[model samples]
Target chain A: MGIALILVSTLAAGVPLRLDLVLPDHARRGKAVPITLRLSNPGPEPATVYLQGRPTAFDIVITRADGTPVWRRLDRAVISSILQVRVLPPGQAIEFTERWSQQDDRGQAVPVGEYRVTGVLPTDPPSELRTQTVRLRILP
Target chain B: MRTPTPVQALAAGTLILAAACSDGNEPTAPSNETPSAAMQGANQGAPDDPIALARGVPGFGGFYLDAAGKPVVYLKSAAHRARAEQALTPFLRSQGLAPSQLRVLPGRYDWTQLEDWFSRASAGVLAIPGAVFVDANEASNRVTIGVQQGSFARIRGIVERLGIPPEAIEFQETMPVRLLATLRGRVRPVVGGLQINFPGFLCTLGFNAVRNGQRSFITNSHCTNHQGGVESTPYYQPSQNIAPARVATEVSDPVYSQSKTGCPPGYRCRFSDASRAAYTSATTSTLGRIAKTAGPNNGSITISGNFNVTAEGSASVGQVVGKVGRTTGWTAGKVTNTCVNVAVSGTNLGQLCQTLVSARSGAGDSGAPVFKGSSNVTLVGILWGGIVNPNGSSTTFVYSPMANIERELGALTTF
Candidate 1:
């Protein structure tokens, strides 16, 4: 450990970090879609937050309008056992971007359809944090 | 652990993927680390200086600098004045002083006696949770025990049972101190004070080293899946998914000792909170170098790898020290107490003979390297835990001393 500055925010100060998913509204079939997750500390005070892993630490799901699952990231992938925690200063943000290759978990190209992408951050207590869902449309 | 459940169409688990780890926080510049004038002439006597220069003249008393920075050597009797002046000559002249400027006074107790009481009372007092520190207060001629607010009675009872006379001991209430481990970002050919990840947790890598022709790095044993077990748990830089490859594996993590030799009541003891991970190739590691952050408060940019560690030694009380971690880049403070037996709350662990520093530390700073020089460094210890502020940062922290590190991990050539 070299140097660290913990803003030392209280739990009453709310969650120390904020999380969100960033993706395009639509992508053409067979083309890779970039999935970005941003974790930031918007501080009036310092906060301690955790992310299980980078992109792998989150469960990114793409489902149809009818709630039928289209594809899932980490659906059967081995989640690395390591956990990461950061007591971040306010205004500090870390972003992770991964490519979703338009294919389903089974390696099949998805048919053009309306879809929604959501992310979940699972912590040790088993209380999972879910991001607001974003809509996506796959083109033929 | 963000793993997945395949049965559910929308998995509710975690996965490990590599992401470019970056720190968005600004860091504070660390103060230069040098012996404070008040702490000069410590036990490390130059061949020319008397061994008791600052620690006091044993039966006479101790030495200190007055408000104007002049040397003050206190004694128990006017008869010792000549000896005190003679002992302070070379050190005084070196500071551009004549023996005429030396101040002498009759002190209440011999420093040697107070130091003995401190040593005798530390482990037992620290065994009580909330007993933050045990210090030898030179000016007060008493052994000071800093107890957290609610822990006073518990600490007082233990100290009383240890047979220290009430007049010779002092108590002060303190705030909560938390264990700290911190760091972030992926740096190739990793260095100390960077983020290293293990299953279910993350911590800072202390230093890169070599043992028996293999490269290795040290981190807090608590960062491992098991604190003192050779589980061979793999480690990753910054985060595991970045390359999905481990930087090293736990090779040695000494079991907590069952014997109570250094332990207080009801605790298993370990000399250091350290664990070593073996690197398979020399190409993936470097030795004696810590990840250098931009000078103080600017630790967000860690590309420079020039902070050099030239030697390993014990940190004396009152010396300044610094550390780097993934979370808080660079923070520095003074070494307040030495050889304190620290108990980690919520665990059965008692770290014996640890050093305490008042610095800015936070979660994820575990295993951070602590050095004593500002321009360069003399490696002293590794960050393990601290008393955290309400905001989650540490104002006073604890680390395993170099001697203790070697006690359990064997002799190491850590420059």
Candidate 2:
């Protein structure tokens, strides 16, 4: 099993405003899964953006191979009302990352198995901004 | 038809950059297009409702007034001018109206037939592969269809299949319309100075306010439908059809009161162009913080920080103040006029005791919050309309003073 966790960052081209997710090919079990989120401006022009409150706006969900929900980032956590706005220059990016332990919302860790992970940057006035689900393996 | 109202007051909706007006007549224009003198005329069209005139005249197709304020009616043929005038005499304001005053023009089709073709074309226009949009152009008295140039022949065949008369439709070359790119425009805990979308218009929020335990935000009265007596008009943040976008419902938009004291005999008058929309959720919006952008609008705009409100006060002529709006971003200017009587042209309504600022603003900026600070400032007023030249852009922006806003909306806590 591997020991390090890494996720590559990328910026989409052509599209004016985009939020992309980055994850390393695959990671070993028992190690913390480092996930990265970036709100990028791929278009040539600068953009004025209003973001949903931070930390709260970023979410992740882990599921079984067959698509059953396992753990969600925002389940019972109370979210405070927060509104944020910032200007993004062309070709630039902003990042929000979270390290997820191999465990679910509950403190218990799962047995060695294959799972799928998805990231979401639910900006306000929500858009079709979700990361493609990636397969993962938690080695015993 | 230019009203003799002050130059600064007629273009008052310049409260916005895209210049959205909060007066009952605003956002009547598309919320995103730049507020231009021509656009205002197009939105308000002729004050006389020609469609209403088309109601009875046999084969009548259109109606309009000449520059001299005389009525010019359109009929299926010049032969019907005498009969048409006889038919219209009962309903029209015929006094002082010379027989030559009721001029009649030739039209190709009957208004009824055009209406039927419009309905059929509307349901079938988009079915044509290259068709972009459809409209019942009353002035031309025909169903106007916008389609790609190369696809005209294909659309013509498709139009025949849809059973719409070929002679009744005018095909024009045009490209498809697209939605604005707005990934960063949506806000949670909805803040002031951002765009707000309604059925067919976009406007800016003024400021978060609280009156007697109720939480809400202020925009222009025109931002709503102006059908008073209910909190019915719903607004969405950034745009419609998105989750968690419903931000507020109009709660207060009082009808304009008329008086010889401050208003013309036919025009309506009000203390402020302000109105309130209660937040849909208790925690859906934030109070006193307005979005700030680094510079003027240059196509791609971005928010920098916010001008946090600290107190509430008034400004005198020559005193500088600033406002942030969806179209123009953040811009400021000196107080040009402390108070003046402003007339909203299209609506035949006037605002009394309003303030004017010589600031750079545009369409969709209506309902922007006007204040007197850079980062920390005192709440002063809410932007509504503007004053512009007959064929020029607006140079002065107008607003409802905080004192007048409170007087019209009742006491509210804005900071």
Candidate 3:
């Protein structure tokens, strides 16, 4: 009876939060392609979402289909890396979006292939962390 | 490995030689850029006194000396007291109005007649009537009259007696002329009783202007016949006229074909395209002589670029236009009014699609392509004259509409 109560309480307090990774599915070679992230806050109260970046987290990595990484270190990116956004008020839902491009970093040619991207989000305790992943294809 | 033979080296070189030699000898010039070759001699150091040059260039179009020695350009002639008196004498006497109420305005009339009347009035004339509205066709073969400021009823009665269509009359009391003494040189005669042969005339065999299956090569009526041999306006001597000319490859001249010395400081001489071709097929041609000759006689010939004789595109107010002329080169302008009745001088009469005032054209700007943009500058109108004044400062030109020109030219023959 105690185990059932605990399970019921956990289900009642749990939040149904969903994060969707948005990006261009395909892009021509040698073009500055954009990648977007969709942060959906599905709750009655507003939620503050933070994108955490390292003190020197100015690097972008493009990987080949075989999982070998092709990365470029950026000297100075144009826009702020961390996007702090507020959710919509009340039951109204809102989408938070941010875009980055290959032109932001100096890199080698992105050969035609399918690849995956990942970003890490940090929470207050430092121990609790959230991660996001996206899949995209580069066109010739 | 054995050393390669000389023949083997030659065979390797053949691969490099195998590539196509397609790039032409010359490249295209920038659209708005004047050539550098002519620039060296075009700009002379400024004169000590700019007014000296103005005085040197003989005042031609709408110019006169003012009291301060500075030349004032008037877009219209100063009121001609005598001409006004002549035009108003009948009206004033008939109206039984006193001389004080009916003032004789001095110096103000169309440039066509103003030049003659102004010279005559300057010699001796107490005061000529202003805006007597004479049916004067002078200078650039323009139909101009004067205006009178009085009671609206009196002005109406005078205007009625002048017999000018209400639309043709402008009530602007003041006409503008060139502010400086500028020389308008000799007005190039459109037809010097000579012929022009386009050895490289581009042919649009009347295909574009016809109904289903009808064929004619688009060509100019002026192109139909001209003077003999090289003694012609364009000085081109063609062996014969081909019914249909094939498309010739485009050609541009980088070097001046013939150097002309002593061109005025601001002017430069450039070579004109003298290309030609022959057509083997027929199509409905839309090009024709839109107006009579530039002279008093209606015998002037027209030069044409290849155009499809398709139906004229829609006419609109405030649209852009372009034209290719035999003398004035290529120019562009805009449409001002439509179906305007202009008193065309000489034997030709009636209204034309009136073009707005564009300075890009002049007397010989006749028969040039007057169309919007790159589309076949469908021959739209004939440029007769501009809003001219006696003092020669600001003259805005007007053109006959293209529809009227096309209707008058009859069938559009395309090559």
Predicted structure with the largest TM-score when compared to the true one: 1
Real A-B contacts recovered, model 2: 0.00
Write down the C-alpha DockQ for each prediction.
Answer: 0.05, 0.01, 0.00
Query: Which residue runs of candidate 3 sit more than 4 Å off their true CA positions?
Result: A1-140, B1-311, B345-357, B375-398, B411-415
Clashes of 3: 85
Ranking of all predicted structures according to TM-score, beginning with the best and ending with the worst: 1, 2, 3
Docking category of candidate 3: incorrect
Q: What is the TM-score of each predicted model, taking all chains together? A: 0.44, 0.42, 0.23
Report the C-alpha lDDT of model 3 over B1-415, residue by residue, as the tens digit.
Answer: 0111111112222112211211221212212223243332332323332221211121212222234432222222222222222222333444453222322111223344433543432232213344333322222112223333332234434554544434332232222221221011111121111122333221111112321343222222222222111222221211124222222111111222123342223333221111112222331112232211222112223322233323345346677654443333344555656654333221122222345535343332322334444433344444433332222121244554545434433434322
Proportion of native contacts kept per candidate: 0.10, 0.00, 0.00
Q: In candidate 1, what are the lDDT values of residues A38-123, reduced to their tens digit? A: 66677667766654432225567778888787677655332222245556677887666678888776778888888888765554
* Runs of candidate 2 exceeding 4 Å displacement: A1-140, B1-184, B227-231, B242-244, B295-300
C-alpha RMSD values across all candidates: 26.4, 26.9, 34.9
Best of the candidates, lDDT? 1
Clashes of each: 56, 29, 85
